[model samples]
Target: MTKERIGHPPHPFDPARDPVHKRSKQGDSVGGAVVIVGGGYSGAMLAARLAERGVASALIDRGGDFGRGVAYATLFEGHLLNVRSARMSAVDGDPGHFVRWLETHRPDHADPDGFAPRRVFGDYVQHRLATVDAACPGLITRITGTVAAIGTDAVVLEDGRRLKARAVVLATGNPAPRTAPAGASERVIADPWAPGALERIGAEDDVLIIGTGLTMVDMLLMLEGRGWRGRATALSRRGLMPRAHGPRPDVPAPLEAGLLEGPLSGRLALARTVAGREGWRSLMETLRPLTADAWQAADPAIRGRIVRHLRPWWDVHRHRIAGSIAGALERLKADDRLTMTAGRVVAIRPGAASVSLDWTPRHGPARPALTADWLIDCSGPGHDPARDGLTGPLLASGRARMDALRLGLDLDDQGRVLDAEGRADDRLFVLGPPARAAFWETIAVPDIRKRIEAVAAALQ
Candidate 1:
């Protein structure tokens, strides 16, 4: 055994091509320990928690830093965490863990309520994993490769390497959005966070961004940070921007009485009732803690109704932006530098210098074709794993199946992956976004941290 750097491995290790394996007839095995695929926040926190309990685990991820993944791997200085530092802890029971770590590590921006740069958070995740690795030598194995398929007792890589383990966890984060419409300009960027995605845009070139969620906010900020002076148009079904976080009062009133007691008719009724009393923002906060249970208790038909009728409204209110970022957006709007429209793009015509988008307004007649120098897709990730190449194999072979809502992979209450036959696999577990179908609120750090802690305890 040789000592090597945990994260910055000398080179990518292909398990199938390991020369040392030739010395023995045994196939590649991680000693039958828990092997976590995807080293994002979910995987890193899971591995760290397991290590804390004296359990060694194997972590496998694709390119980039082990823990950053897509969200925190942003190189743009303007990309900030949507949540405050106080609530972004990677571990349960350690509420101030992330802020405390930042105090010693980066005192300049260590305020508990401050929203830190996303890359800083990424560094925090990597540091957490690194600390665990240091305390428990040889307890965490970092593998750099993608898992092509999952076997009953092992994971097979794309290169034909096998890692035998007692259990496997899929923490694979968000998948890239689907490809752009045909005949669209080559300048159309499906993944806004992709490296050099915004590099080719000129200072005065007009831009059109699809989707008006947090991802669109990120793109707007990135463009503004780069001193983009071109006109920008954001299109979505509702064209609603995320709300801004505000100063919390010293004391706040409890949620309105009977807000959650009565028979639920629909999201609109609930929203109007709550908003009439405590306001929509407060209503969201009040429901945030109970979202998982509320979602679980509701029948699939009710959930589907909410997803169809109230998702956009709930999304804008639920996922908010930093006050500063919201202020910048307002400034952009005030200066006529940005415009948001509620419509759906019907067709795209690409020209040599610009692309024309034909869209129909939500309630009005179809508008004239709008042209832009660049088009970006900020519609967020596709939720169907059965359609994704990486996770499709598992679904095709009955290792996993889509949930009723098709929002994410199906899993049991204990985070165990349910097979196509609807049987929980004791040896397989899932964490993070893929588990959203089972746990609607499983994507965020707070929700994922609890899930990771529970899964770690189960594995231990």
Candidate 2:
């Protein structure tokens, strides 16, 4: 079969002359329409919302997994959502949307508070997209291919096909783990999420994971599913595991308006003070409504300080795991099968059978060299555009610039991509984790859904 180049030939729609609900003929394609560059959760939600508003758009992704980004693409039964089913809706105002979908589709596993498998969540997202596509017909076009560059008026695919669009949305999701350590590519697995990433390991092979965050938790779960009996070592700067989520309280803590106005230390101190009265979980929940505002209101220096000093602590408390996963982790620890260390890797040497690693503890002297059959870089995605494929051209062409933190692309409060000259582009928009530079909480589903709703409203 001949390969069809993946990209929607844009659909024609004139806001002034065309009926709002008019549906294009099947296979009819137009130009200068909305084109979203990623078909993951962000892009899927945005497209669905736009379709709900009688708008037409094209969704492009390399993997062609319209709703399942890297996060939910995992088929592992043991990998579950960190958030409960009740709060994992794709729509902004529909808190129970996902739970309702689960009831209709997978009733046996549809507990509102239970953490559903990531695959189930992926199914829910795909179902939403399918529902929208059926209702809107040709309004949502699915394109499967890599977007190589973002031109001023079009997106250039890897195969040199340029699809013109009036507006472009960069919902490209998270980056892969930093490139494997030099000369250790064969022994190091840079992306734990990649297909077949763990297929080469034997059941008893020693494994070293580079981070003690959610990714490491995922790796551990996958290993256990494979019946791995070898030792696993997780190393991080703080060696902190994500806290487990308990039953959410019936009532939330009172809002503290003053929390965002003070110095970083003062704000943290206030949070601690409140945590003393209401538990830490409640304090964090209370801060949820105000997180974006508080993050934006803080001085850049203060934000930097928070990232440098309190990030690890914040991460553990902010991104909690499921109780079941936590129990499994504890069991592994109890069985002396897992080790968590706080240290810095001094050097890495590749060997025929294993990789040699030299690490120094955070506070202690250097330890003896260690060896691992496989070293997985689970430190999460790096945010540098210069090092990324799609964004690199945008940066080189001055079409985009890095944020002050260099954690993501520079964007305005309205989610417009800013040029190298620091000017926001009217027709170019961005959502998802890359917008974290402007909205610190953009990585989560709730935040992404809100952003998608806003962007869709604005485009409409």
Candidate 3:
């Protein structure tokens, strides 16, 4: 068979004439005090928080079971948390719950400091759900179905049902697996979380993953779990692997009370403070509590500047991987089982059995071509309205609109949803990553836990 090549396709934009577009699938009326459209970390924590506040809440999940979102629902045994057990509790009220659980349950398990199996973490989240079930403080329900539409004050399910509520939370974790480059579909493994994503590999098969972040780590461990010995290549702009978290360093608070009130000069002052700190982990640990303040202090203009200059560096620095995962990656690099190439993808061609990829490596004169038996788009995509399959129609139809970053539903400072004219919707509320404009570092469990608490408090 002739080797087919592939590369960068195009930026996604299609509300009309797009094959993936669909209308709202309104379900039967199911009234919830607060209807959350996702079942991930953010949604689960918010549900419990709402119950604590004596509010009725219901969560609808596509996966059906309670605690398993795309990030947590992997059946693969080798997938582990990038964070340590101490930082991984599903609930913010009990910071050490995960660590305590590990000690009580899997004390004998190896590498407790390293990444723990994602299954155990998922189980802990499930257990939290079970606890909420027993309490019955306020109405919090879970439905197993897809989300079809999100109205101004209601959530519509795929089965043509709607849950009109005072608030709606879009806690859908990560976006769907990206569509591969044109002609790359034959060898594309679009969804990493899908069943048999790694199992499709043969012992001698070569694999190419689009990014070298946590998902790549998951893929590595999954293959290692299956005893599949193969060559894998990861490509990205920097090709920089996530930093492994070592012993928690003693990072002092970097900013004072006025540090958050930023206008470029103040930000420089904070940058100087960070400069004094030892490393990225120390910088983040100090900035954790102060993040919301800093985020709110900067106007959208500064935020955009940061996105352009600092976001990529911040991601690698802040989102450090587990020590064990990093160690394994180091070993793989040493053994040449795993390889990472730094560059932008130029093209791809999917053949019957293998996909050919063309990449420009770090401004190097020569663009290289490599073939892999399978390719997974680990380059994380945003949970755009279209990908979520619920809010997209509303946005295109002028019922709603995207924020500056085109992430989640747009909202005002007080957490009120914004309509197409950039006006706040009185009866609607948004939470989690969709509210990222209000809270920059909100994707983490610790951050989400705190946000959920505030969301609950605000609702009361």
Candidate 4:
């Protein structure tokens, strides 16, 4: 357990005492005793939970925008929450918490099944944090800066300042996607979600997007909202698009005893049988409760095969998009404004005003090179910590190690980060996307809220 250091009455955070503003000697301590790195959804929620438990903490974010994070920081109204509002409660053990908050805060979108804009959800998160802080003043000290390293009992900032912390929670969510191919030049938008990434492109320029998952769908929606007249081509290996949301079953479909206890192939076969009878949506929702156990129980070789060959299929079926969004995509394809191609990009050649790529079709021989005014890589967030700048310091110092599959950080079953020596560090813990390797179903709201509760219990 973490050393008990936050058992005193809370005080509001004073900017004058913030360690970043004033230089600190080797051991000068300041701010909340417990520090949380990353003010995004996971970090903010954890801080709120801790504060409610009377544990003061310092919440730090490089972007300085608390609660929004990458997922909810969007100004685009078209980017809606993937999950329905009824299940998006910020409070754990209270399923209707978000719905009640929505009725009071955003009545226009108060329907229990309606999908709220992500920005509104961001507002809700910020409001919850503020409300908790009001009740427990001085507990959450919000700091805006990039974290350089985490010491035994302090957090080092890039500006050479340090905040003394008895414990640290690395809630740095999704890292930016991997860099594009070498010499892809300025036409390649490596990360579409970056602020103003698509602003420079001409309205009529043709686009070639990599990947056909939800990120690709988001790009299309953003482009359509921008009133762009450009045509787009979404390229992927299997060209399978995300399934649309459907009516959830009143009762979860039952699985045979020990159905998921067998090999990966056997489990997939069972999934097919269930989908054929109860529909794909029912099959996916039913599997949610057991996915992590199934993932853990599988042999390492089977896990690798699942990732390489069946991941896209699993993702599309499990992470369904809103019906309206799916309809928009269908209309775009029907209008000849969008194209979906199944292929693999072989090489890229940069051009002065555009980018050219040579790719092989999934079924045919090498095809003619495709050229586009801009090549946007819509591949999802990168998970490797070693390549991430913020998480790199931990890897360099041997305080953290990557999982065997390189999905995310290596973590114990309790969500504590594992060091290079394969021992869990009590002073450090991980939550949300960074813990994906250990918890397969952790990225969604329902799963994340439960994780926050568990981590809060462990911390206290």
Candidate 5:
């Protein structure tokens, strides 16, 4: 295959004009189609990119919509994106693609620096996919179903359908939030993003949210929008809420060459010194582009130390909330309507009317038991690959292996999955959060878009 043909595959291999067989017969040869599991932004964007390049792909998702994953599926107007519009482009080379889309579709809210509602961004993603699909008709097939497992050269669906493909990309995005030890109960809302879960709470319900990160912020916004007059308490180990966004700082000067190579602790000390001079936010902004490189360079022991000691602080400062949302949260705190507690729930007793929780503070002894009319677990997405329904089976079957730190599926530099014996699979790949083990900064749109470009360029 020539360099030019890498993107624009020969017409004979075009699955668009000629669809791949639904199922492979015994002893059948490999097909030309690519199957992408997970219809979230990553998967959808990958399909669009492949389609534009004259390759054929099947995008499978359990959700009804193609691009509106859990993060963007919110209908609440208060669900604004954490990142500014100028930086949230879905196109790799075009940083202002999203802002341009906003100017055309929503002229009233076209400020490049302003945060747009996530739902609108979801619409923008779907629109882009539609445009690509129209341009390359039949190149991208949309399948609405859950993937049961991945075979050697095929994607098996939960409904018993099999799609034979030359390559399969796992873009399953973030897994569902981990359930609490209390188990399932009507009074406990395990996953706040679940359809109609928040709506079930009455306006007078006293709520206990077990997280203080972005997901916790989301829960607060949802409650405030519903005019819930009752008090709410958010608990976490460190009580570290995400900081609010502000004016973008100018890019800082490069770090010293010596600062970039050292133990994680030494690097962190360097970060502290820089933050003392330039401020923490500026340091975080400066570190954004360099995080993945630094992470990939670190040894597993260093990575483990970072995860155990610095992850929470890194998350709050790195992934900030919208300024408007921050102000609203502050107002609630000032009014004594919302409380942020640093603690862990030691025990949960479910009663007919309410749930009682015994929480132990970070620095103090166990506090008195508190009762809540409803309990919501917004502790964020689960991280264990072995716990994942679709990918778990692959790991058990020795088809895939977890990363050294168990942060995500083990993947090579090229996004190919590493098998149980530490071999990269040429025909299988992982993307987005599932591949976070290899690329620490793979979750954001800009990062994932660039990844799609690389993967598409490398496709055989």
Candidate 6:
């Protein structure tokens, strides 16, 4: 089975090594079951597993129902997951679970591992929910409401309702992208996640994008689909692009033979570890479980250093490009329709028809002006805010502290939320992308699935 991408050396599970950090469970209990918040992939997977074990759970979401988090809430028929289906599984051990599910459901399927549309994945999650629900009638429940407050062992709903359970799981997904620097005119489009945003802008309108990460990649593909013929500019801190993943290899891992113990020299250190061990893909596959250890072992001073100096490169290395999507981006580059500039947007001034961005180059005083008919903020997901999502309100009120790295909420080694006094909340558990500060590579599906499963077991 395929593992999550961690890019560290591997190790077989050793109970003696105690990879799992311990938690203090002596404080409080709401009795027999737990309530899962944020019903996306993480919530769905955990709910399925918990219900399978005969433990009842309340799967709650404020969105458009089950499986429709930020990623699947769109009305588009063709929005796709960046990663292929083969690697996207709700179960931690069953790597091909999603692929097999799609095969059984969609008989006319042409590509299983290929990037399928968002609706297809959403349907699969819905099917799993139905399957799990049918297996355990009255054992699992779904609630559609926004959570206004999370107490010790209870969640207060916005509608003045309360849900009390033995434990709580926060599987809240990534937040939406922040809006672009606003101008007086409509030339600047802030919320790209809004429905029909890409469709409203025509192919002939010149556009400017804020960031150069995956969101930019999605927009680039969308533009290609719309036959956008006008010039585009992607401006970011580095203007660095993402790297593409290689072919999958099934070689048995040789990295599990104790090669990960030292201060690795460079890229060659990685090469030597994987020597005669596995293909590049195989090596990466084995390293998936050890990245957190590596991240924790990494110097804290250097941690911020890495974020400042090497974040762009790290993002490209971790978040690879799909082959077909890469081909589309290549065509855009070849046609001279897309240009990536490394600079800072000092200000956005809107004219009668177009928006002009005042720019300053890296270490150069020659500040030039760049203009676009329309501007979209592709700067990636939001962090803490006052919205009704996951981390916003708690952070705003100091119920929980943000990580020193500013990565998400402060969490313990076992994924317990650390409150304002730096103590783990006994009744609360946290998982998903925002946990990245504590568990560096925990955002992806595979790693997140394992964490959810492990935490579920711990709760049991």
**What does each candidate score in C-alpha RMSD?**
7.0, 5.9, 11.9, 6.7, 5.6, 7.0
1-460: candidate 2 lDDT, tens digit per residue: 0011113221232222336555433332436668998888999888887776677788998989899999889989899988878889887765777787787779976999898999999998998888777767668888898888787888888988888887899898987877356345678887787799888888999988888999999998998899899998888888999999876532467878657776677777888888889888888788776788777776678778878999899889988898889999999999998999998877767777898778889987778876899898888777777878877888889988988877788888789889999998988898998788888898888778888877886776
The superposed Cα distance between candidate 6 and the true structure at residue 134, in angstroms, equals 1.1
- The model with the greatest TM-score is 2
138: Cα error in model 2, Å: 1.4
Model 6, residue 248: distance off in Å is 4.8
- Clash count for candidate 2 is 1
- Candidate 5, pairs of clashing residues: none
Task: Between candidates 2 and 6, name the one with more favorable TM-score.
Answer: 2
Clashing pairs in 2: 10-30
lDDT of each residue in 35-102, candidate 4, tens digit only = 88899999999988876665668899988889989999999988888888888988776667677777
Cα lDDT for residue 12, model 2? 30
Candidate 5 lDDT over 59-156, as tens digits, reads 88897699988888999989999888889988776676778778777876689989899999999999888877775667788889988878898888
lDDT of each: 0.79, 0.81, 0.69, 0.80, 0.81, 0.70
Quote each prediction's TM-score.
Answer: 0.89, 0.92, 0.84, 0.90, 0.91, 0.82
Error of 3 at 241 (Å): 1.2
Which runs of model 3 end up more than 4 angstroms from their true locations?
1-32, 103-115, 179-184, 248-250, 253-277, 386-388, 397-399
Arranged by TM-score, best first: 2, 5, 4, 1, 3, 6
Cα lDDT of model 1 by residue, 1-460, tens digit: 1122223232221122434323322222376778999988888878877766666689998884799999999888788898889989876766777887788778877998889998999999998888767755666889999788788888888888888888888888887666355235576877777788889898898998888888889988888788889988999888899999876511232665455555556445766876777666677777777788777777788789878977787778778888989999999999998899999878767778788778899988778988899988887776678777756888888888888888877888889988899999989898998888787888789889888877976876
lDDT accuracy of residue 334 in candidate 2? 98
Model 3 worst lDDT window (10 residues): 1-10
Worst 10 residues of 5 by lDDT: 21-30
Candidates 4 and 5 compared by lDDT, better number: 5
Model 5 has an lDDT value of 0.81
